[model samples]
Target: MNTGGKFSDAELMEAIQKNEGKNDAIRFLYQEYFDSLSSLITYNSGSTEDAQDIFQEVIVSFVQIVQDGKFRGESSIKTFLYALARNTWLNELKRRGRMTQRNKLYEEGRDRFAVPPSEAFENREIRKQLLAAVGRLGESCRKILALFYYEGQSMKEILEQTSYENDQVVRNKKYKCLKQLADLINNDKIIAENLKQIDHEQGF
Candidate 1:
């Protein structure tokens, strides 16, 4: 694995180009970029599992770029890799119905060289508080809410997965758990401030 960040761009490209040492090249890429890329997803309302999934897709894309012979060495591998990861994550957010208008505008303006700040909606403090609030809920509430909201599962699906009597039971639990979370946020002055900033920045 490329554990020491000692691999050069040309060497990386070459490694990917050649069949030999290909797995090593992939391992090297994972060793180098996984943590940062995973954090990018996790901080943007994604769970660790979601981050892992996104990074796997990013690796596939990185490999394809190299194999296609279009890498061009135009930028450092890290820059290109990051651009790919961020774009992929943003698209994932959109597919999950998590992207807001602010995210849309931000995506439109993103540079190939840098990820913009996550303040508009995916605020770090907001993420932190949300996780905390959810953690404070009972296990049933947490599981139900995560399934319905984060996992985007339907009430029927949730009913099948849980011990609920029916879809209505699942729906009621979700509503109450979400309400509890909203109350938590309402009580947290810092979270409220961060949310206000998000709306203001997004021109909402």
Candidate 2:
């Protein structure tokens, strides 16, 4: 079976299980599987951002399972990853109370690859609006928000990544940037409806 990278399936599994070159293995997984797994969400009732978040969650869970010796290798890694992504996305949809007809069909073992035209359009609009909102932010604010939220960097890490003098400065800047982003998002009804969860998640 093609493993989609320099490492074969067994090689990747061994690296993960033994904690040897595991970072490389994980990076390989990201490059090889992210597009396929993320499409599982984006083609469903999820945005690109949602797909990215779910993929990250799935990678963490997969690493843990491997370390715990729970991955029996009964299935190919690709199959296992797709299963994880599907289940994770389904649970997210349930949590958001967005189990639409397509989702119901997915649960019933129907084809879920078909993207509804309206959902595609709405996803495009949401991306456009979000980019516009981010563009309105000052360069420093934009960098701070991107590092904290999108890259999941801590204040200390942000300080190291940027020219900030200390953690306190990074934290203060991040808070202000998040507030500005929230304000921009709130001003647009469509963007607000799509991204309202960020405010709660970021402790705004």
Candidate 3:
């Protein structure tokens, strides 16, 4: 079994199809594609948590198709995975009854104009307030938020940085930290006013 640091697409497919080094193949998928695949969800009004869930589903479906001898090697694995991720996320949005809203947001993103000076100034102010709120969180919460949101570290990467026993532990801690941050932001009068004003301006 070739358990080297890298695998060509053909090597990965063969490993997966034969169930030889399948675990390593899956890990390779995560390491090579998680960030980009998850971006599809995140950019479409989905949370990082949502992205993670969708990517897991994509992996499961991809493996099954490969093992069933249904995945013809016409398209590259990267392209196939991307299509699977997109379709899965679209189905999820439809299931949640948010497909229409998602389309509206996508259109707005496509047709948006450049930011005006006033809106830009307001955005900067809002960011400052948000950063201040994050700063006020406890040390653990601050570290988790900074690593995940600011530094773009994966949960597994965060597990390496923190003392967490596993990725699930890191995820739970991160979720609690996010809830704490949200509560803190909601309870702050000034920040609440700023958020409201921004939402109003954005026609939300």
Tens-digit lDDT track for model 3 on 8-114? 99899899898889999999999999999999889987899999998997897788778877778777889888877776676577557777765656544331222
Q: Write the per-residue lDDT of candidate 1 for residues 86-143, one digit (tens) a residue.
A: 7777866765787877677657855644433442234645755776887888999999
Provide C-alpha RMSD values for all models, in order.
13.2, 10.0, 14.8
List the candidates' TM-scores in order.
0.50, 0.52, 0.51
The segments of candidate 2 whose C-alpha lies over 4 angstroms from its true place after superposition are 1-5, 110-204
- What tens digits encode model 2's per-residue C-alpha lDDT throughout 92-152? 7876777999899887862244322222323444766878989999999998888888568
Per-model CA lDDT versus the true structure: 0.76, 0.77, 0.79
The local distance difference test score of model 3 is: 0.79
**Between which residue pairs do clashes occur in model 3?**
none
Q: Model 3, residue 24: displacement in angstroms?
A: 0.2
Sort the candidates on lDDT, descending order.
3, 2, 1
Error of 3 at 100 (Å): 3.0
